[model samples]
Target: MKQMSYMINQRYMKKLTCCFVCIFLLIGTVAAQDKEVKLKIVQTSDIHGNFYPRDFILQRDAVGSLARVYAFVQKERETYKDNLILLDNGDILQGQPTAYYYNYIDTVSPHVAAEMLNFMGYNAGNMGNHDVETGRAVFDRWAGDCHAPVLGANIIETATGKTHFPPYVTLERDGVRIVVLGMITPAIPVWLSENLWKGLRFDDMEETARKWMKIIREKERPDIVIGMFHAGQDALLMGGKYRENASLDVARNVPGFDIVLMGHDHARECKKVRNIAGDSVLVIDPASNGVVVSDIDITVTLRDGKVTDKKIDGVLTETGAYGVSDEFMKHFASQYATIQDFVSKKIGRFTETISTRPAYFGSSAFIDLIHTLQLNISGAEISLAAPLSYDTRIKEGDVYVYDMFNLYKYENMLYTMKLSGKEVHDALEMSYDLWTNRMTSPDDHILLFRDKPREGAADRAAFKNFSFNFDSAAGIIYTVDVTKPSGRKVTILSMADGTPFDMNKMYTVALNSYRGNGGGELLTKGAGIPQDELKERIVSSTDKDLRYYLMQYIEGKKVIEPRALGQWKFVPEEWAVPASKRDYEFLFGKVQE
Candidate 1:
């Protein structure tokens, strides 16, 4: 009987052991199947209010619209499933008629950017420098309306010294964690007025990044870390003393990020930077105006519920090939119509057509119109202005609000500052240095230098500096000698009224707010003035935007004609006149008569 009982016990134990083994095998199989997870992140930066497929400024079919970008995002989402997240790297709250209308005109209603971003279901967004420029009321209201987190680690609150916006956001997908840290360039104090950036302070990118990286690694323990920077790839001093663009430096210095994305100066880039641990980190910049998007794919491997391996791949995806989303257009069709009506209103009439293309080589009606308005409105002795557009033209006929957008590209205010006669001369010298190159020979290109050119290309001229920064002075008689060096290029003859312009005498000068804020270094570097001392020199400032003043000025007249002051010209006209004509014809396909 004992032997039979022992046999029964042994048989029961064998059956139990086999059942446990089968259960373990099933668990192992399931774990093996679910060990790997893939995530896709798409980034859009420097969108600059490109909501529609058409350019309201030019009144033409514009490339790189947000409607097309939405379609691309939809396709990517469909291809990658819910494992994908959409992010905007900032600079979305300003730049176009759509933005300007919703921002200033219809202030009571919801902002266009907030509505669009919420509708598109963006996961996160960073605060750009331009976003800060929109003033606290506009940006703060927009930030509140957004469904996703508006982040800016470096944008600190002056009262508490803490970030005004949320520093970072954490997302989890299929047991894998993702941490995204947002940062903006620390040059806001340099470019903007206290009214625009009140109660906020911006910090250095690399320092802020290092501090957050350590905290996130220890606390969140994320499987992937992403840095969203509203800055350019190159580390350059943009606002005189401040290094506004520093995206590349943060990626190299910060240790834990799996990927970094940036935009501000509007350059496209896609590459990798390895961390101290020898792990490769992907970095991408999608340029500006919604032209491109940064797409990233990350593969994370886990074993026994612990992350084992990770890999990331990033690229800049062009949105030009993508079609506009009908759904998006339909969603905001009414808003578009309203903006169209707003921009289409007739303000005044022009007797003759004008082009800004000639403004780069010499003074023209395009920049001179702005100068005339500046001097007339501010009632200053001298006026300074530049061509805000490269190749915009308005025909002889009725002028509309849309034409004003082409006339002045930014929402800058008119400023009158106190400058000495010597300082004004120095400013003109710097302006011409950016405008023209020293003519070593008459055969050399007069205004532009094109290093590489297509054989049959109609336009081969290229500028060393942006054409918008090529400033010209009105109300002052001056000559720019291309034969001389930079500082000695300008020879001021006298004031336009033939008054003796004494070097020791102080003169009130009318100019745009951008130049007064040291935007182009014409004041700080060229005029040998300190940046901090700029506000003290402000004799007067327009209460409204320069565009608004221009519109009011033209509307008050009802019949308007824009012409060049022609107070300043390039010397050696025998060489310059013909060269200017040839280059103008090559660039704009129009012969200068």
Candidate 2:
């Protein structure tokens, strides 16, 4: 009987030991499931084709580039590995000669922009207004070539009522699901020509975000939702619909977004805004040119396959601190050589040196050259042009293709639009209102000076408004009286050929597409043309960008001289001359001898 009891006790002990082992195994599994997962999301916006450290236009070393960004991203990937998410917020199709060459010149090869993004392992990208400005063929081809998805939730097809690009992309890492919703600024129609964004309509950010958030929550049920917007943070009413910079508005009004990344205004911002549910959402922008990147680290705690808690930290990391990635440069060496060769080719020769500096105080050869091109190409009676660059100079010598970039800053096509002579006068009035100040005395500032420059402001900070909007006429002679008020400052004397200026007469005017499309409101606000009617006035438009035509024009001329038209000047020379000199010194820190 004692032997039987001993055997029974051993069996009981064995069963008890088995129970304890099972409990231990269960606890281990639970602990593993309840642990934390970390992810790093890096964003680059408004890179504007600064792929290399070298400035293709200036032929000098620049501080920011995708080469440097790649170096920084490489280091970050060492820690995050598969958990690292890389995204680009558009405007990649314009700016440098590299993008221009790939966009227009090289039609057969895979765009270098796409190749670079793929090589850098970008997870996704968003379309920018400028990308749309490249027209459907270029952007569509670029999107098709990229391995990662190009998302644009708010860009909808007009015909089908469907999103033009993929609305969002779902990414999974370490059992955590992330949803990235992309949207571009809805102000594309205001700044871009209709043909550039044909068959597509930009939707409001707030409405689109609300719709996408509901779909994502009900369908995707993602652990985290991110907003990748190619818009600004500020909320400004544009075109009587959605705000142009609606990133901040979407973050505050919409729910379920864990983070929002913004661009397009070229302003750096980093802050946390509370959503409708009172949850903290991080909004960040690294500004433009790849000088900085938005770096975000997210730690998510999960239990039983469900997220219990999350911690997010964001910062703007400067790429200037990092060196250019050697691998990145070596891989794209051939493309770089091609762009270099393209920009370096001699186009023609300049008889005299020209600078945008004189264009501000009075007429200058720099702007007149553009006016000459426009009038000659469009056969317009009046030419409206501005000093696109605030302070850029081209010396007297052989001119390369790169120098054309300095001559004309944007890829705007030349436009020939019809306007009444009175409308032209009013447009000049508004231009001068934005450009000059009402000077009571000669000592007062000639150019409108800002009371105080905004924090972290760069060039053009001293001025009250944008230098690009300071338009001056070349085909007509006029004088701006400083003593008069804003509306009464400009006085049109006669046409360039001394023909009597008639306010009732309708005249053909040559201008850039940007102004023609009501970019600066010069046509709509000053000229008093309704926004809808501006398109009807387009008499003709160039087949290519103004810069391309300017190059061809220069090449055809072989040897050209650029001189100011002397068609316009400031009146009351005593007050104007002294004020102009003072303002020039104040703006550029030196006076032209």
Candidate 3:
């Protein structure tokens, strides 16, 4: 009986050992299957509504269209397959006539931008500051139409105190959990009118990132975390409360993020920054207008359903390599034709030709036209205007709706603010300080130029005065003496009607909403006007944008005549006369007739 019992026990033990071995082998196989996942993240940011390769404003072929991006994405999709995720970093809902048409004009129809993005299969998108500038109705509608989640983790709803958009999204691919959190620059409240973002509150980017990272790491235990920051690389403080460009700060302060994509400032960059955890994290910015796409490749390793190791790499993919996709064009061909017809419609006629290039030198019909319209509409005592573009021209005769876009590059509203004549002098002084350099001799380069010529390029002259900020006043006669120093450069002589300019007397100044809101610091820093008081000084504001008023003003007149007010001039004609001629030819490559 004992021998029989020993034999049964030995057989039982052998069977148990075999079962354990089989279970171990099965666990090993399952672990091996879930061990690795390869993911490719493709991104487009600051695409300011360039769905096509054509420049709707210029009516010519330009770079950085969604068609070009589609071509690249399609090719990349083939390589990445289901493991790929596509995203847009924001600033898409507004910009260009194409977007403006769909945003405000064609309200009943399906949004073209959203439709295209959905059709192309974008996994997610972030709301840029400019996107918020489009107002709640426009953005809310656009976001509702997007098939993918449109996220802004920091955009809090005032009533609910919760995120207006999805704060974060988690995707599972081959057992690897990937979490993406989206945040926009909190400077929306700083730059935009409060009415535009009335229901929403923007939180600091870095702070938002930190809070989300903790939650995602603890609850989701994500294999990888990616940050889609619709902010810039710069750490510049905006409104002294938050950083406008806080991507780098987030990367350094917030831990557990494997990748961060930045936008808003429209700079192309890719680098690695060590996180607080001392692990290298990749940060990339694809720049603006669909010119480039930020590509991130993440390699994750897992063992027994747990992540063992992970690595990520980032790079910017240029859109130039891929031409416009025929497939994409076919999809949006009808909408494209509609916009073409809309922009082609004649708005008014110009009495004579005018170009913005001349505005940089002094005053020209181009900027003066804007000044005339501002002064006429606002009925202000004086006007402040600037050349919005570097090299845009409107020829004589028929002008289309498209021409209006070139005339006004941005959708800035009209603002009439109260400023003392002394304050105006200080503002113009700062404007010319950026406009001109001290000229000791006639031969010295008058226009701003590069310190060194770029290789293989002809000695290209660049401007220290970003033509957009080269403000010149109308309704007030002033002299910018190049020989004088910055603070003393602008001398206000009298009003356009020859009334004596009084220093302490308050005058209503008509300018763009951007300037009135302190864009370029011409009013706040230069004029010594307090930033907080800017809103109080506003005498009038347009319900619609200045561009809209400009179009209406032209339509009413039928025959639009734009000419230089000649209210301001560069002094010391012996030096100014020749320098203007030389610089104009150098910059625009056209002879001044």
Candidate 4:
């Protein structure tokens, strides 16, 4: 009788276990159905023409190859019911070799690069500040050939008050509306000059977002709102350790925004940001220049009358951990191998030492070379070249065409603008103030050059690179007194005919369009002058690019030589900041307060 009771208890326990399994399976089925509404978003930021693996300067091993990205994006889209969209946050041109041109490449158009990206498939992107460095023409070319939408909400043609590129794009996926609003950094005037952005203005970002989001929400009523912003990430928790930067500023203030995709700071951030109204905006910015990509899948819940919670799925890995396309890698390797020989060579050395002292006046031969090139080729009456090159690897007497190109990586137009001596004086004074504030305060800074100085010292690593006493071939002359302080540093300004500078009279000064429209504060144009430094009416200003001019100057031959442009001569007597010094505070003499 006891044995019979034990068998009966075992049978009852088995029945109970079966009942629990059935209930569990039913719950899991519902959960799976809920998650099936998830959306996949594939993002790329700061691609900046990094269509291929490792660029000229960034010679990292196994750094890049779009094959991995392409395959991954395809697989993800396929997995997510073909609902995936790829986006570039910003800065896709001028950083790499592409269907574009920079001062770094010798009339070499990035044809293969353009085709490669077209094949890989990009849906849309924002216009980075560096993208403007390509100027309007190349932008036209790249856009004409691209299969994606290049967007910018605030960037405008000042003449028309209309957006130069599309402000936003909306795609209807099944029963969902995904709206992607693009926003570029308003810091264009800070990084690039006014000349490159002729007839353009970057509107207030906050205001633009408010207006666009409102319009899109009201008219299209997109099911999802995504902001493709090219902004830096926030500071690290304790130290400046890597942290994601998506100016949640827009997310918090701008209503109806669902996600913010940010770039420009070169950080990989994938997380949920809480706005002021207690709404969650998904933000992601993969590492810059094709180092990494962030994949995020999203799901929305709205069971009640009011909107409910949204979810972010974990990032799917591609490229970095897993290898990229073998064919793409093979092609990139072959071309890079050929280009490496030229970039790696050290040309010649400086017999005389160089300097970048007194801030306002000229200091380095690198500056002189730029001025000489601009002046010699354009044959302008006067030309001014600021120190655009950074990280001078050229030891004394060792300079290569590659080194020169590396220093000046942008291709901007040369222009001759009419300006009174007073305006020129003001610009120089501004540069002085910037230099002084940069050196003394060190902490309080705004200008790009003042902040990090590229290689920790733009003027130092860039300016004092090699030495020369080059004569100005552009019919311009100036003198500098190193003994004087910055405000009163400049001396004689002898013209093409050795005439004195007339402050009240208009003089046609030749310079890159970037400087003419005030790329740097040192070159701001006056109120009446054309906003674009390279606007037509000035002689030869309406013509070709600096690279083309350089090509014509060289005539397909080796012609770069050490020549000093006597645009400004500095006195060796006064003590100025040394290029070798890292600390800037000591460089600026304390005020007599």
lDDT by residue for model 2 (1-593), tens? 99999999999999999999999999888777776899999999988889999999988997788999999999989999989999999998888999989999998899899999999999999999888888888999899889999999999999999998999999999989999999999988777888888899999999999999999999998999999999987688754454688899999999899999998877778899998899999999988888889999999998878899999999999997878899999999999999999999999999999999899888889999999989998899999999877788888999999999999988888999999999999999999999998989878888887887632235456678778889999889999998899799999999989989999999999999988988777888888888888899999998788998999999999998988889999988999998998888877778582
lDDT of 1 at 535: 86
- lDDT, candidate 4, 1-593, per-residue tens: 99999999999989999989989999777655532256788887766556655555434443644656775666666677657777777677765443243323533454444455666667776777777776666565666666777888888888898898899998866456789999776756533444567788877667788888878988887778888887754522111111223367777777677778877665556777788778887776776656567677777664422235566664625466555666665656655555666556554444543333322334446566566666666666556555443233333454444444444555667776666666565555444444332223323221213232222121233222111111122344554343445566455466647788776766666676556544443543222333344344355564555655654454433445544554554334232324213323333333210
lDDT of each: 0.84, 0.90, 0.85, 0.57
Clashing pairs in 3: none
RMSD of 2: 2.3
The alpha-carbon lDDT assigned to residue 328 of candidate 4 equals 62
Candidate closest to the true structure, highest lDDT: 2
Q: TM-scores, in order shown?
A: 0.94, 0.94, 0.91, 0.66
Clashes of each: 0, 0, 0, 19
lDDT tens digits, residue span 506-574, model 3: 999999877887776788778887778888999889988888999999999999888888888888878
Off by over 4 Å in 1: 1-19, 29-34, 238-240, 275-277, 448-461, 589-593
Worst 10 residues of 1 by lDDT: 452-461
How would the candidate models be sorted by lDDT, starting from the highest? 2, 3, 1, 4
Best by TM-score: 2
TM-score of structure candidate 3: 0.91
Cα misplacement distance, residue 158 of candidate 4 (Å): 9.5
Give the CA lDDT, 0 to 100, for residue 568 in model 3: 83
Query: What is the C-alpha local distance difference test score of candidate 2?
Result: 0.90
Question: Candidate 4: deviation at residue 538, Å?
Answer: 3.8
Please list the residue runs of candidate 3 whose C-alpha ends up more than 4 Å from where it truly belongs after superposition. 1-34, 438-444, 447-461, 464-466, 577-586, 589-593
